[model samples]
Target: MKQLVILAGGKGTRLKDRLGDLPKPMIPIAGKPLLQHQIELAGAHGFGEVLLFVHHRADLIQEHFGQGSRFALPIRYITEKEPLGTAGAVLAGFDQLADRFVVMYGDTMMNVDLTRLWSAHEQSGADATLFLHPNNHPLDSDLVETNAEGWVTTFHNRPHAAGQFFRNLVNAGLYVIEKCALEPWSHDRKLMDFGKDLFPALLNRNAKLFGYNSPEFIKDIGTPDRYDWVCAQYEAGIVQRSSLATPQRVVFLDRDGTLVKEVSAQGLHRIEDLELLPGVSAAVHELNQTGLRAVMITNQPVVAKGFCTEEELQQIHNKLETLLGREHAFLDRIYYCPHHPEKGFPGERPELKIECKCRKPEPGMVLEAQRDLNIDLANSWFIGDTTTDVQTARNAGVKSILVRTGHGGADRKHDVAPDFVFESLPEAVQFIAARSTETSGE
Candidate 1:
């Protein structure tokens, strides 16, 4: 059986503020964490045995997935007390790895066909196979120049060299390695990355390191904005959510105005005022029964405005859940931006207003939600009552629907028009259900 090793030890320092208290791999995309998706993908690719290398938050990972049997694959964990570079982590798990194994970065997500990658490696008869993808911004990444036969000729770490080779290809952070490749790395060496160190050493020894080029979706969620983008792609169906046993889709809704009446501009000070629009609960229930996750993305500037505290917002959301529960409907997840643009208000500050990608119209919330939830945006849809919501979907490259309830009806007269418009939430549900039926040939 093919063995898979995932490097899951990164602290994700770049995303510390946004994903506090969680390891980089545990950061959520839509509703599920990134690590969950990686595991699911391994299972999907038919890997019977898998290994996870953990250092930071090792307990969190172990607690959540003890054996990985639930995912139909056997998983083992190796914890490191000190920092181990990419190659080191793989070497650390050397005993567990099979003669032929696949190694990948845990914090990054990709839709690569492992079967094809493995086939290529076997056909080339190479000691190692490196996955490569076209790079538009080579300067930001380590550039790899390859020969006509797909053998990597030179590896440049952030080189300023200007040429066709620079724009040709870059490492996609996925690799298949034979057990012999690890023999050369000195056991005493520390702080080594595969691209910068191991691959170069292999090249000097004239080892067979072949490159496999395929059409695969790859993204590095090293920063908050990238995290958001990956999530949105999943929601829009641009990329498949790796968590589900079978293909699953979701419709992300903007809460404040799309499902319920817009919180009064003066503010929703009371729980009783939280009211759902006509047919809103029923529409959401329909989606839930159909195996779709109905997530809420709202911008509650109230906390930043000092109209209420974060606690107040949580209480209001609690009230919303109670109200919806009465109708047998539930929200899978709720994401809101509490920061505001100006600091005139006592609790608010100009820094909060400084341009942020997560705010509505920026696609940050939708993207992050997609990463956590694994929603497919191209196959999924976003329904809201405001232009910002529509713009958010557009910026994130997802389909947008506008419901007549709340601010939606008013938005029709604005400059941008939604892909579809409905007089009420039920109408939108009916339309989507019919479309789904048509798609499934039922």
Candidate 2:
């Protein structure tokens, strides 16, 4: 049986109106306490027991779910004498935690699949695996950067430096921690935090930290507006539907001229040349709010063409993510095909001059996305600015929306016609949203 540790010590001062005299975790969500929702989700995902760390109003929490028999899991409590920060409180109960335990904030509304997360933790063999996700407000949030292997490289806290474009990966306040990683700091009683203090220290010491990047639903309902919005999302079924445990309906987007301006056929090699089309941000934001996971599937042959390296291509995408973050939009993931079939180009990498299945007009990228994201292609759509995109969608057995943005169907390379055509991504999203509404009605 696995164990979960929840930090339920928040005083709820920000949510005073909703809390009354109850603790923050006791705030109502879907006619039950927020902690109840966490517990239920944990139980569904193979967490057989829970260990709650409490400080403020501990009695109320203990009184509601004593022994956890009703919740179908054994419950235990470790009451903290003072308001130690997130890491401090967890470290305070160092001896009580299992060898490897999952930690969740009691204030957040999350539907993560603990079984899947635990599996990832086991496979990676990391000292700590932090559950990270992209959010719309990365500008104001503490950011975490992971390398190509999904290992933690940097932690960028709030008050981000100006003009620096970072990936929109934010620490979503969920973790799978190995207790041995905390033994060295367990004796220090100072008020420490995870993102702000502890994580950076771990990285400084070359700790084996892994980041599990996901597109799942995890949001903190700390403030009144956030609480209201979370409650609305819960009632609308977005909270549960957004989890990775179930199949997701994705809106696969073409990068150039669809998400950003297309400079040339070879693709814009310089990061400065990147510019997003009008209404792109708002439309993507709508897809996010309406429960459609937006994924970008682009064909960038620049790496094979010698125009730019893969590193440069990543920075360009990072800039795109930063721009979208400013407008409160995020992509679930970005998949691109960098291999070019044609050979004998000057300064080209001979190794990459081979035909790859992931190229556009082939079903490789979409198929890979289908597997990685558990996407339901029959109910999904591919919005692009060219005929090849429509052809790709047709090949993948998904509905296609051709936008008149970049090529606007000018290229006759592919004879396939899209199921629908729109002036831009915004209009296409609107039509798709309406169609979703109609389908839900049935």
- On TM-score, the leading prediction is 2
Query: How high is each candidate's TM-score?
Result: 0.55, 0.98
lDDT of candidate 2 over 179-297, digit per residue (tens):
88887897888899998999899888888999998898999999999999999988878887877779889999998878788897667999999999999999999999888989999
lDDT over C-alpha atoms for residue 81 of model 1: 67
Candidates' lDDT values, in order? 0.75, 0.91
Q: Compose the digit string of candidate 1's lDDT tens values, residues 34-90.
A: 888878877878898888899998999898888987888888988976887998778
Report model 2's TM-score to 2 decimal places: 0.98
Please identify model 1 stretches exceeding 4 Å from their true place.
162-165, 241-442
Name model 2 segments beyond 4 Å from true: none
- How far does residue 305 in candidate 2 sit from its true spot (Å)? 1.2
Q: Cα lDDT for residue 47, model 1?
A: 90
